[model samples]
Target chain A: MFLSFCDGNGSALGWAVLITVVLGVAGCAKNYVVLLPNDDGTTGKVAVAGREGVTLLEKGREGAAIGGPAGKTFMVSDEQIAEDFGAALAASPQKPVSYLLYFKAGTDVLTPESQADLPEILAEIQRRPAPDISVIGHTDTMGDAAENARLGLVRARSTAETISQLGGSIISPDRISIESHGEKNLRVSTPDNTDEPRNRRVEVTVR
Target chain B: MLAMRLLVLAGAFSLVVNVSSAEDAVIGYVKTVDGDAVVLVAGKATQAEPGTPLQRGNVLKTGKPGSMGVTLKDNTVMSLGPDTELVVDEYLYSPSDGDLKLGASMRRGSLNYISGVIAKLKPEGVSLKTPAGNIGIRGTHFLVTVEAKD
Candidate 1:
């Protein structure tokens, strides 16, 4: 049975050993985690800290048993993943999309290009079910911190207002949250009193 | 004298209310649901639907055939499968102040998690606690399943 588990891969022997050990201790309910690839096809790492030690999972579909010793990992079959996470996977919502709408210097007015992109932002919100939006405004570092904060809020409020007006019945006023990051969060890093166009913008995220 | 005392008591009560309201700002919202999903707030269960607000310390649960999806303010996405019970133990997402944390505990069932700005900015701050062990997120996607203990 252990030999049958090996698929002639370089790591087959190690996997067979792990599978044998896993089967030997199958009394308790199985608890585990699987590393999956991101939507963009990039893989990241997860560190599972068990009672014994930590196990780092770096490959897609790679899994490790919870509450067990570290260094014990095996590839989770697609069927097993389907059976275990089918509902959670199915319940996954559409990924949120973000838009950076640049503003005119020291003003709440949107740049011409950003104004043209408003419709696309509206379409993204309308595409989702029960969509909610967050408009976070930022300002360049050319003014006083407190004043920039107020300016950021003004920009955010204006953008949110425009979005609500364009969305009309599709968007509820309560679902839109507006905040200001001010000079504290600049898109382009610059010294104090330096003007940067990219830093003066409103970020809209539709979820 | 009694009226003055009552007025002072009311003043104190309003202060407490304001503090709590500011502290418990909405951290996320339910974006999708199928069948019987509920969010437990202040020990009371409310049927969850799209646009339902989520606060820290709330419990998200699903029935035998239920499932739910939520998106946090930082764009972190999470979905729960049937018979799942997840608690948002802590959440702090003030990027300007350099405060970013996301922590949750899963008692049972499955969860699909996608990293967001919190994990991207401070990977050490994101964690998912399970009955058996804890998982540290590092700006990626993963799935976890914790079977009920016998």
Candidate 2:
């Protein structure tokens, strides 16, 4: 009877230890929810109290800071999670890069250095899948606004033609668009009729 | 009875874990794509195109020569320049209820942002995160750029 009692006590102790471990794990892992708490608080700041730390949040604003352990579990508010926060966690689109190919004075011809950069730009466009191209022309303030506009378009058209010839594999005619900003949008701002080499260029946006 | 209680506790714990990691929700759609842009969500890359519904937690990445324009539900127009990485992070907007929150993070590249209803209603509610520091939106139109880290 004594041996049986000892065996029974040992089993009970083992069960208690298992239960404690499970309970402890749950306590440590309880996830906390973020509370916006105030709707009229757009001008007002809301405090997000989390295990990581407290973050003071304002309206029309977003951040990628840690609200919790993984820095991901931010919005679990009173059984109504802020789904928009999840979208914030998701990847947005990448930014587009542009290359400016300078042109010769009063002509649509590309400068030697700018011509050299054409292959590099083409390679950049070819690296992507079905890229879109925007060819915008600009000129120095040396000419009249109306004439500069026409010249810009001519420059853009010439660049487009070159891109078409060189970009056989990737450049579909429909994917390319040409525009002339002319002297209206100056790369280097100067007085009217001022000639600037930097401003006489074609800006190509390859995305 | 003890066994039943233990089982209940374990079940409850599992449920909490599942709820905390719920799937991301869609917030807006891609209005335009100039080149090669993609939205990275759940480890999968989705080509960004017109009418591509954007979700919270989506990471936007552009290729070497890519650009993307996005319109949010509240009419917030954002144009992203190439080689950019942006995350929506969090956005909560309900005008009638007066619950407005917008948050985003730009890891690299340039973003041209025009204020939407959220910013108009409460300018202080909008915040943008960058490598330099946090940007609090007071004006309606602005541009932000985060260059690539060496």
Candidate 3:
């Protein structure tokens, strides 16, 4: 009986030692940052400035403790990531989408093709929950700066009105914001008095 | 002459108000909420819901089972997991004037961040502060989890 008791105690100590080692290695630090690939499958770098030093993360799934010793990183497994960030990832909102609606030169009227694209914008607006949009108008450098500013505002306002009219009850009027970038923001850079068709457009971003 | 002077003074006052109000305009909106969350503006807590407008200096907090997502005017996307607290300390998005910035702080909890126009235009202007350290984003998607201090 004395020998059996001693054997049982030894086994228990071995199991405890194994469990402690596993836990120490697996749960080293709870505070850390992970780099994720962009929707396009391209990865970017992140610099974490910690107390000891800075660590740069460039590859997907590469992670480092926020309070780091620079250059120290580990690969986070998919299971661990899901357990840690499932809620936050699941709660991410839909990414915003932008559309460029071309306008007739010197007017707020949409081009024939742009007019047909209005339905698509309306569809997107209806698809989102509590959606908001911004209509920013841009003008070519063909006119005076002040005049272009006014024209840009006109285009933005008219485009917003069209979206509201088509969306009806799907979106509230207060949710649509209008701004005018005028000749300052040009899609295609050109000298003054140059007529660039691409520059004369309104950008609508649905979020 | 006295009436004209008073009118001028009133015009100046209104102009100042207009400029200040423009600065305090809504910078983003709460796009998604699950479970329980609140947005604290000027220290006053309001239950967060879809369409809730978020201004600068707002603190977003979530309960144990809560989650929230927000999309800023510049298209930056952020989501917070349960028991999380984040503050939008500063935001300046005026691309026409070449002014762009986004500064935020995460006191504790998990966050999912996706870069936006501001990051693309001015990469150095964006920073996320955590208790452990500061994160300098170079226009990418990332996840952060800050454990609560005992």
The most accurate candidate by DockQ is 1
Q: Report the lDDT tens digits of candidate 2 across residue range B68-118.
A: 877665556677767788998888866535778789988876666655668
Q: Give the DockQ (2 decimals) of all models.
A: 0.79, 0.03, 0.76
Candidate 2: list runs displaced more than 4 Å: A1-92, B1-150
Worst 10 residues of 1 chain A by lDDT: A1-10
Model 2 chain A weakest 10-residue run by lDDT:
A26-35
Order of candidates by DockQ, top first?
1, 3, 2
The digit string of per-residue lDDT tens for model 1 on B1-150 reads 999999999999999998788558999899999999999999999999998999999999999999999999999999999999999888989888899999999999999999899999999999999988999999999999888765
User: In angstroms, how far off is A152's CA in candidate 2?
Assistant: 0.6
Per-residue C-alpha lDDT of model 1 across residues A1-207, encoded as one tens digit per residue = 332342223556677567768886343245888899998899999999866789999999988777656766778778978888999999998888999999999999999999999999999998998888999999999989999999999999999999989989889998999999989987889999998999999999999
Summed backbone clashes in each candidate are 0, 47, 0
Tell me what fraction of the real C-alpha contacts between chains A and B each candidate also makes: 0.92, 0.00, 0.87
lDDT of each: 0.89, 0.65, 0.89
TM-score pick, better of 2 and 3: 3
Over the full model, what C-alpha lDDT does candidate 1 score relative to the true structure? 0.89
- Residue A2 lDDT, candidate 1, scale 0-100: 38
lDDT of 2 by residue, A1-207 (tens): 221221224555566455547664232221122223222343333333333655554433322222232232222222222222222212233334579999989999999999999999899878754456678899999869999999999999999999999988677876676778889878789999997999999988765
- Candidate 2 vs candidate 3: the lDDT winner is 3
